[model samples]
Every structure is written in C-alpha cells, then in structure tokens.
Target: MTRNIWTFITCGLLFSAAAVHAQSADIIISKGTDKTTIDASPFGASDPAGRMFIQVLTADLVRSGWFARGAQGASEYILSGSAGGGGGFVAQCRVAARGRSGTVFDRSYRGDANEVRRLAHEAADDILKALTGRDGMASARIALVGTLSGHKELYMADADGQGLVQLTGHKSVSITPSWHPDGDRLYYTSYAKGFPAIYELNLRGGSIDRVANYAGLNTGGVVSPDGRWMAMILSRDGNPELYVRRMPNGDPVRLTSTRRSAEASPTWSPDSRQIAFVSDMSGRPQVYVVGREGGQPRRLTLRGSENVSPDWGPNGLIAYSSRIGGRYQVCVLDPRSGDVKQITAPDADYEDPSWAPDSRHIAATRSIAYRSSVYLLDTLGDPPVALIDQKGDWTAPAWSPGR
Candidate 1:
C-alpha cells in the first residue's frame, strides 16, 4: 500500500536515525566467509524522501531474520530502489564489491505506487539470496494481538515486529492472527460481540468478514496452502473437535467424529492433503495427522504434557509446541519415523511455533517475566533468540509465505 506521509515521517524520525547509526555497527553472520564493511550508498531519485525510504527499506530487511543487525553498516554489496516522479516506475539500483568501485545491478518496474515498498523488498531479497545462496526473510509478516483502550485486538506486524498494523480493532478480545497462503488477508478469532468467532480480515480493504460462527467454540483456524479449506476446532458438534471448512463460504466438513476428547490446533500439511492436529483422545493433548479425506490418524509426538499447534514444515518434518516440565517449548518431529527433536530450551513458556516460509526458521511466542514476545529459532543454529522484545505482549506468530 502507498505509505501515508505520517508513516514516512515516523520512519524518518525514528527508524531512519537508527539505521544511520546502525550502519556503523558490525554485522554478524553465523554462516558466511567473513564480515564485510560496506555502505548504503546514496540514491538519486525524483522522490525527495529517498533517504528516509532507504532507511525504512533497510529496517524492513533487517527485521526479516535473514539479515544481521546494522545491515547498512556491513553491506559490502550496496543496493537501492526508488519511486519515480509519476509514482509509476520504480528505478532500481545496486552496487556490489566486484573489483574497483563495484558492480551495479539496476532495473525498473512500471506498477502502482504501493508497489514501491514491495519493489524495495524484492530488491533486498534478491541481494540477500545472491550473497548467501539461501533465501531471505523480507517477505514474511508477524501476527499478534493489538490491544487499545483495554480492548484486545488483532494485528499483523512486519517480520521485524515493526509496521504494527491493526487488523481488527473490535471492542473485545481478538487473538490468533493466522495467514493465508496468499498473504493478502488474515484469519483470526475474535470475541467482538461476546462469543468467539473466526473472521477473515482483508489487508487491502481493511474489512473484516466472519468466516465461522458455531454454537460453542470456533477457534484455532489455519488455512491450507491451496486456499481451498481451513482446518479449525469447533464445538458446534457437541464438544471441541477438529473440523475442516471450505473457504469463502463457511461450509464445514467434520474431520473427527469423536465426542469424548477435545481436539484443537489443527495445522495443515504442506501438500494440503493432510492435517496435523492436537487431540486429547489419547488421554492428553498429542500431535496426530490424518488424511484430508478422513481416515486413520497416526500419532506424532509422545513427550511432554501436551503437544499443540503442530505445523508441517516444507520437507518430511512437523514442528509443534509442547508443555515440557510445566513450561512450553517448541520441538520438531519426523511424522513417518516418529523421531522427535527439541529445538527450543527457553527457561520460560514458549508456545505458538510458526515455521518460516523457508522452513529453516521457526518463530514462536515465549512468556518471560510475566510478558510475552516472539522469538526466532534457527533449526540449524544454536538456540532460539528473541526477535521482538518486552515492548508489548506478542503472541500467535504466523509466518507468511515467501512474498
């Protein structure tokens, strides 16, 4: 979307200054040849706000969890993009540490002005990928709750936890902002009028539409990759049970027929042909996967008090958050072999694990010192590191598909 003038000013006065200062700081790479010192070279564009725009772009890049902090300072390969005068064409620019001066990578695109930010993001993603031979995080978004005036609301933030945009400002509790495969809209649960219901909020139109309204419970809704259906938990059938509903029109196709055990946290497999959900049918909450057509379910995790929010990763891996030793932490499992591996050893409760679109990083919400925040855990790295600090309570982190 075309950023408001106020948004520009806020970025200029706040994050821009930080970016300039951060440029002087060192950039660390867990897996790299060596750290390089480069600059966020100047950009000449018709738009007078190019500096501030670049700062905001840098901030966006750093927040993706792919780039190191103070990126502008250590960017041996400088890159830039700008919106033109008519707001129609975006002039792209880049300079790499090729030999003398640098090698330049430049391009232009004729599109909507709102695409300016997207173009910048695309440029950053390209640069990062070319450098590391791995994917970047610029294309991700964060899902959290935004409370105002004692009302709990739903929000979607940039991957860095900035650009906090409220998706639902209902005068009630609205939590669990999940993303569709397209990333243009958000699916969340809201208690706007007292009863909890699932709603879809469109980011472009700022409109909220109810997706499901059952008699007892309607929560933990996650859409499949094909965008054809949503796997959620509902109590309309009598007790809390897992259900799959067609999108656009809430026509639920019950997946589980059990009434004795409560089932929730239904996550879809990457192929969209199966669903991994949590069921107490085994006496406690455990991870189980069943075919979309409904058949025999194979249990996954066998440790901890309860294993919830089982998200299927890109490959043959399933990640879930389980309460271990009275504290919740994230763990990974091989659905076929039933092999389990603990990824997060956080001293506090760490729940709601959302796998990054790259399948390399897992973002989760952890409770520390009575407050909650989001942490990014690298599957191949050391441990989980907090991404969003103790500023505000953040939960229900749903990573957007690579944009």
Candidate 2:
C-alpha cells in the first residue's frame, strides 16, 4: 500500500453514543490553578439565567489557562454583574482590579431570554480582551467531522461546545475540514462522488462548490490568511504533493517534486508566505516548512517519530501531535527558538491538534481504544476538557479564525 493522505488511520474502533451532558451552563468545575485568579459576585442565584451566565463566563476564563475563579477577596480581579433583567438575559458586567481605582471593563450585553449561553460567550470574549489585550476564542466556532448518522459528515459548534449544529447531511464520508479566512466558509474533502474531491461550504448561505476534482488525491484544501491563494495536496501529475493556486480559478504552482515520498497536512504561516506540512521524505513521517515561492523544504521536527497535523497560530507557534510509544500526545514547537514542549500527558492517544484563535488552547482528537471525541487542551498545562459530550467518533477539528 502506498503511504499517502488516505493511508493514515485514527483507529478502526466502534462508535458509542456519549451521554448528553446538561445543556445548561450551570455546573461549576472545582479545579484550581496558579494562574491569575479572578472571582465573581453573586449574579442573583434565584434567577436561573443569572447563575448560568456566571458559570459559563467563569468556565471560559478558566479554560483559557490564564485565569482561575477564586474567593471574593482573594482574587486579583472581581467580576460583578446584574445577570438577567426582568424580561431578557442581560450582562451588565463590571471587572474591577484589586489595586486599580477604576474597573477594567464595564459593558452591557443583551440578548433573548433563552440564549443565555450565547450571551455569556460574547461577554466572556469581551472581558478577556479587555483584561489581557489578546484575542479571545470563546466567541469563535469549531468545524469537525462526526459519524452520527452512520457516515462521516460535517459538524460545527461554539468554542465551548454549545450550539452544536451539524452542517452536512451528505451521507458520505467527509474529512479534513479547513476553515476559510473569513470564518464564514469551510473547505473539506468528501467522497460523495466516489472519489476524493475538495468542496467549499459556505456557512451563511449553505452553498457548496467544487473546488478541486483532480485525477488522483484531492484533499487538504485550505485558504491562505491573506485570502489570495489556496493550498492543498494534489496528485494529478504524480504522487501526492503540495500545490498552491490563486483563488477563483487560478492555475496551480507545484511546490514539491518527490516521486517516492508523499506530502500532506499543509499549514500556512501567519504571514501567508511559508507553508508547514507533513512528509515521509526522510523515511518516517516528519514536518517540513517551505516557502510559497517554491524553495527548499527545511525539517522542523526531530524529536518525534511521526509528527503530523501541524497548525500554525497567529502567535507564530506551531502545534502538532507526536507519536510517543504506542500513543500520540499533543506538543508545541517554537520555530524561532527550536525548542519543544509536551503540553498534554503522554498516556492518552491524542492527535489532529488544531489551534484556537487565542493561541492558548487547542482542539484535538482524543481516542480511547474504541471511541474518539474532540477535546480541548490548554497549552499552559491544564487538563483536557471534552468539547463534544454527545457521541459518535468526532475527529478532524478545524478552528475558525477570530473576528
């Protein structure tokens, strides 16, 4: 068998339906961290909406790996809010620092009475940006592949796994979902036509267009951050290699000319000039970076046996999975310093790491023998949190860009 994009296997395991967790944002996780501690005042526990708002907001903050909810007076920042108004869900939130004389952020967010989770997500992102001056991922969406209807299809949800909406009903196997730069569209590969073809799915209008229907492998399609070109793995001429083409029906520019080795999983740099991808040129699979103008490919990973699925974040760090022993673990690499760090525990089998918009969290696939679920892993050493609780082997998570 030729080793290529389709040769990769996550595990041929049976699917088990995961129990639906309580849909409300009411649970308060009891984990403490040494990160900057923040706490909230009572948001009218009598009002269910109020309780839910605080819980969801605090949970997002904790999951960012930067803040931990603490006691009223023991934290660095205090969050107070009039959670729900008489008729609607409201977030009249105020964040006051311990020593600062004025509040850090004072804003009001209002939405429908039933959309408490949505309101909390918006407010959490606002508070995170106001405090740290960094982009918040709480309000972003994640696109992934699921096998709920006895076939691989597209599924999307909020950053916290709320408002999960299945996007595709093709009843065909779909994989390798990559979000468009505008965040309003996704590029995925589907076998609906009996062969691997790349299609673009527009989220706003629910329209699908065929982007690549080449002779051989047509997969790993992604748009550059600058929105000028698209990159994918194509084997129309020969073995699967990396190609970049101008958007809107431009001719492709082949970058790799290897006959014995196959290339896959291409990720663009923040500047959209360099692409980091996986290849088997050195015997085993490894990561290599090449310029968009077609130059020499430089090896990036020497610490792992099979390093694949590289996602380059705007913060300039690349996150990927490293095979250790019999299982794969999530790891981060600093291309500037050539240093590597293993963020997640090595015991579990985790792969297909995708970076969140904030660059602090990653969406990855965690396989447990016979089942797989999308999980959230913090780069700051926080424990993994399952993104989707409802079952059916979710994999190939693709995080959308921040607005």
- Top model by lDDT, which number? 2
Distance from true position, residue 176, model 1, in Å? 1.8
Error of 1 at 170 (Å): 1.5
TM-score of each: 0.78, 0.88
Model 2 residue 2 CA deviation in Å: 41
Taking all chains together, the TM-score of candidate 2 against the true structure is 0.88
Question: How much does each candidate deviate from the true structure in C-alpha RMSD?
Answer: 11.3, 10.0
Q: By summed lDDT, which 10 consecutive residues of candidate 1 come out lowest?
A: 23-32
Scored against the true structure, residue 128 in model 2 reaches a CA lDDT of 86
How do the residues 200-309 of candidate 2 rate in per-residue lDDT, one tens digit apiece? 99999999988999898999998999988899999998889999999966888899988999999999999999999999999989899999999889988865579999
lDDT agreement with native, every candidate:
0.69, 0.82
lDDT of 1 at 77: 57
